[model samples]
Target chain A: MAQSNGTDVRLMKGNEALAEAALRAGMQAYFGYPITPQSEVMEYLTMHAPEHPGVVILQAESELAAINMVYGAAGAGARVMISSSSPGISLMQEGLSYMTSAQLPALVVNVQRGGPGLGTIQPSQGDYFQAVKGGGHGDYRLIVLAPASVQEMVDFVFDAFRLTEKYRNPAMILADGALGQMMEKVALPPVGSLPRSAAPWATVGKPATRERNIVTSLFIQPERMEQINLQLQAKYRTLEKEEVRCEQLQMEDADFALVAFGLTSRICQKAMELARQKGIRVGLIRPITLYPFPSAVIRKAAGQVEAFVTVEMNAGQMVEDVRLAVDGTRPVHFTGRMGGMIPTPEEILAKIEAVVAEPSLQHA
Target chain B: MKEPDVIEGMEVVYRKPQTLTATPMHYCPGCSHGVVHKILMEVVDEMGIQDKTVGVAPVGCSVFAYDYMNVDMQEAAHGRASAVATGIRRVLPDTYVFAYQGDGDLAAIGTGETVHTVNRGENILMVFINNGIYGMTGGQMAPTSLLGMKTSTSPYGREAAVNGYPLRITELLAQLPGAYYVTRQSVHTTAAVRKCKKAIEASFRYQTEKRGTCFIEVVANCPSGWKMTPNEANDWLEKNMFPYYPIGDIKAPKQ
Candidate 1:
């Protein structure tokens, strides 16, 4: 059953749940350019926004326009959001950076697809690095959340908006094509009463006694820019300690560990199940927050496991983080299924077995 | 003998607007940005909406617009001012929103945002400063750089084949039904400043009335970038740039 605080449970696509959850999280506006795997988000809002009073929905000419619109709305102190796929996400990188630097709170859902260019409409984990690390120019971080299920997609967007406001920083819900399109039971929470115009920092206009608020990142002075960067870095450090999240599964007694997130985490769950049934002790570490990267859990797992195998739908993007968490102490191997390819549970189970059985790694 | 005063009464012809801060702008001497900035703030003060106005500044010299304008302001990335303004207007439809941008920002890199924001008929004012060359990034050639004009990037004079043609953006935008008001003015002369100020005032009123997109293009002079004295730059602008970019209303709000 779906769960979210005495709300009705319904089977929904990840994208649809995201839209509903945004409404529940008190979204003032949603601006987006449609792309595969995430178009339903805009579609859902366009169809249902009339029923949700006071919520604004607009389709931008492009991702570039959509992101800038979000920046403007967020700067005005409106809780806004935008969603697109890989190629479209690439177009928004500049605006995303601006939003972060300007210290505007926003939500961006990048339902990743295969790409270095307009590669494919199918699912891929290629944007892990872009989402966790700085996607745009400059030194910045997006509070990155990776949702493994449709239910999680619903929950994470709400969490993202909360974290976005709490820190006054942009948060990214980095899902993939598989998760966005997949159907699962999701709980629709009660409608939030916080109005978009209620943002204390928002520019509803200057009042008689209040000072004007300027939302900008331009620091012409080198020292001032450095100070802003230092401040951002300090906030990031605090977030890392307070926000790191991961789900450890069947890790009590295991010789091998599978590190993955999003759809790959679901695949790893089955792989762990398959390995356990075959008398092979394997655990799964599903990182929910990619930025505050569940490194401590990996560090703890290093003492329990002899080897680590990271499985991804991309060319092993998240594996690099896995390796860093393991810190070269344990054998961290990778198996990628890119260009829309998915790793099967049996395949991942075999890869785990091979990690302990062989000196050289085996490909999936 | 009565204490004789040289002047019995002094009249105040002009005063800085309360909408503008006392902070000295970083604009170079003889730059049109200062004039354009003054007129806009004057409109804000005259309308008595300083608290209800939000300005979006471009990534060029006016990126520090927040430092000068005593209203809530946002600094947009190069060319995305219109897009940002659209967002603000959409959410806070009651508030007055405007974007201050340079030619490079409005015509070249930000061309898409500029065109689309106008085309959407967003209730925002766009004050475009067409200086013909990139000001903040030194004397680089811009999309509005005139034919045969020499820039740092176009050192041998702008060749239409190599450097491309100067884009008359406001004129082109006149074709869109969404842009209810489109005007091209200058900031060099006192008479022109008054006209521009009235145009800005009219536009601000239309914005409050929820009229469509209102665009005002100011053909400004750039002394430092053009390698001319402030006086020479004004003369050159009137002689050369004026003939090419004549000031007038390209379109007026639909009746």
Candidate 2:
């Protein structure tokens, strides 16, 4: 097979790239329940998974059970993954909390759809807080990656696995349904040659040389529990330093910049392109890693920019993080679309131009 | 005076306890969870598949069954152990997989999961524990609680008009073609415990032999929930729960 730069380019949807990337990343097992827009991930895995030895794919009874199975396989030192949409991911929060507290490394993909309750399943980025914040309970955080395109979807899966093992924590690819179902050109990573090592802490049953190992997060003593939390917090600090990733575009001389991530980022990028062509000094800061968020970069950019306009598919989740990063040095404006409706580049351009035109908003 | 020769009779040999290290059980005293755990471990030991066996434990009194079974164990969400087991088995076909669940967990909130798993003909074993009432949550009314049975949630006794009748999961699952073996056994007495062991072993064997889904529903007594002494609860199970949830092979592969 001919390869371009040793990677094969293929047209695929965000969901398809996730499945392909997971399999190529040595993910031997997948347990997921089917939900709209994101169901294609399960469908693809179901059709193709049995061809590979050690690869397991199952349509679980619910998102709750699927994530627990991920916990089981991850405990066994297997590269396991699961995928679902907004409400489905909500159902999985309890198990995800357990996985977090237990410090198991696994991958969870959330193809967000609209929801407060059983919302429509077209496309929405309503799970912003749920993905970056602990989503579940307790004092814990997940390594969240946002993929804006099919190529990033493929790349993020491999990165998620590597980071998960490196940190011994759960990682999430927070894509909305728009990215999940949309088709785009993606260069697939090579199946072999990728790193495939489990953490020494993983429980894969005892061998003759070692004593039995137990993987649990429960601590009866408050001091021990506090110690564990401190340890986890230290790990998070290390991750924050090493894993922050983002994409900066045209921010150097711009009067204002649009901050976005995932599919919304793509729209913002396009809007910035259109605005620049019209002589408007607008730029974009698209975050690639939602957790370990690129706060420092935003802080530096805020020094030169007049204002930061945060655009998202949800009402206002990531906006909070953006505001915190700016630290009130500059005004941070917000605009969003919920219930699976996506904002077009034209709409974002309008929002950006409106913010730039307002005299009071420009300097203060 | 010559002291009698004191000899410690040859030091007794103690085998490693056959329980999983993943869980430390929180089962109540005299709960049938211990018996069920022993039976499953004995089967794994006898079959020489301890290293290749994966068990899924559900919520309820038996939620911690993983803690006491010496094998790869997964603790599943309430009522969803079977679905989790299905995922494990699909990925590791050579590994013997089973789920241990309780009445309220499997037959109530998880009813759809259980029925659909069985209907899909998942080649996994299901060990259903029917203890008449919910044990972990302070004796709440369970799907298996009989009519006129009082519980914390059903203080006036489970009136047929209000609470609906008890669910017979074995008979219900046996109707599906995907089920290769379906049996209801008990652990109330010595003979019943033996029978339950046999049923559990049969279910495991069916999965090993690549048969369809094998389901064994064990009619157990929860003295804590029944508000009786262990012996009285066993006797109560014999008199009250047994007839409604009869013990027999609803479907079994031909010998």
Candidate 3:
């Protein structure tokens, strides 16, 4: 694979970018069960994973089993990854919570599809609350990266690993079915010869110098368990300081700003361009990290903008966070499409136009 | 002040060595889990593969078997140990991988996974314990429960009208082309315990040689669930369970 110039030209779907990124980021094991829109990732890994030393791949029995396999492999300190759609990802919540409580560093890719039930295989961002609020049980957080472009899909996975290891927490790449299926030109990263760090706690085998290490989340005592929870909260606090990321476009002199992430961010960007052409001074705040959410950036933009229009593939999930970030300093509006439907750039532009025309109509 | 008591001294010398960890087991007293665990450890010691072997513990009563077993181990989700073991063995082909599962975990929830894994000819060992009931979940009727056995959930004694007949997992698995060895053994008596150990050792040997998927189903006794003494449970297993479930090899690789 030849390295291309670092221009964000694209020719890959969101799922493809994730697969390539896992390979580039030195992932050694991939345990996955087939689910819609995310199946390509497993197919890609099955073919290319073996070329790299230490790469272990398997098609697990179920989404539940796949995540548990990830837990097992992650416990052994192998750079591991798992991918699924919304419903499948839901089944993995128990194992994900276990991973979080155990502080097991791993990557989870959710190519979200429409859902409340087995909703459709089409694209939707309905998992916003699930991802940002820590879908599984306990007072915990997963470092979530919402990528809007195919290029960012590849880049964010590499970033997810770095952040996961740094915080010892599970990191997620939240993409939608459109991003997963749509193809675009992507400049691949140059494969490097860097030696990866070996986790001392991973259970490869008991080396002569160290005692056998057992990775588990079962704490019998309440006080000791509470202490673990407190430690996890502290780690998430430190992560918020070091990991929050986002992209700001033309927010300096704007009357209204658009906030979005993942596939909707791309549509919002296009909407912003069209709104600018129409002389409606609008900008965008595209979140790169959904968990250590880009709150400060939004707060800063709130001072300069009169109103904020939050656009998403789901119905008003991330808008809540945007509202909290502005903290009533300015008006906030929400527009979204659920059930695997993508709101067009024209639709988003129309919503922005409506928000700017009647400032009093903005949501609190 | 007294001479050595030869009989007591000899008895102490011949006792089974404690290979399992000394932690207080959470299993109920008289439960067959301890007996099965002891036999498995003895087999590991006899085969001299404790260093190279890796065990996958399921989410049933044996979820914490890894905590006691003196080897590299992973805890798999309920009934998914075979799939997890498949992942471990594929990556570390030289390492012997085995999954320990219960009847509810194997024949009920994990049947599809286990069947497909064996059909794929994964070279791993599977140790299934069939106690005709779900002991961990308070005596629920399992897929292997006898026709008229009463359980907590089945207070009216399992009837053919409501519940189906017991499933013979060894017989079911033996029909698959990928399954190289399928056997049903028991650990109710001292003689049967020795046979169970030999069967476990043989399964591990099959995995080491890459023969194919080796399945050993142990007809264990859940005395507490059965509402019987340990000895009575053994007798009950011999009289009631064995005739129906039957003990013997269903399939073995040709020499």
TM-score to true structure, per model? 0.95, 0.90, 0.91
Off by over 4 Å in 2: A1-6, A199-228, A277-279, A359-364, B1-27
Chain B TM-score list for all models? 0.95, 0.91, 0.92
The CAPRI quality class of candidate 1 comes to: medium
Candidate 1 residue lDDT tens string, A1-364: 5565677799998889898888877888999998997999999999989878878899988899889999999998888999999999999999988888888899999999988898998999999889999899999999999999898888887788888888888999999998999899887767873433346677668777988888887887899999999989998999999998899888899788889999998888888888888898888888999998888999889988888999999888888888888898888999879887888998887787777677553332
Per-residue alpha-carbon lDDT of model 2 for B1-255, expressed as tens digits? 222344476553533344444454577778888877877787777767766677777777766565577666667667777776776676667778888899988999889889988988988899899988999889999999999999998998999889888888789899999999999988777888888878877877778688689999888989888888889988898899888988889998899
Cα displacement (Å) at residue A330, model 2: 1.6
Ten-residue stretch with the least lDDT total in model 2 chain B: B12-21
Q: List, residue by residue over A41-145, the lDDT tens digit for candidate 2.
A: 989988777766668887776787688678767766678899998889999898788777778888999988888899998788888898888888788899999
Tens digit per residue, CA lDDT, model 1, B86-195:
99999998899999999999999999989999998999999999989998899899999999999999999999998778999888998998898999999898999999
Ranking by TM-score: 1, 3, 2
Which 10 consecutive residues of model 1 chain A have the lowest summed lDDT? Answer: A192-201
Model 3 fnat value: 0.12
Cα displacement (Å) at residue A242, model 1: 0.9
i-RMSD per candidate, Å: 0.9, 3.1, 2.6
Best by DockQ: 1
Global lDDT of each candidate: 0.89, 0.82, 0.83
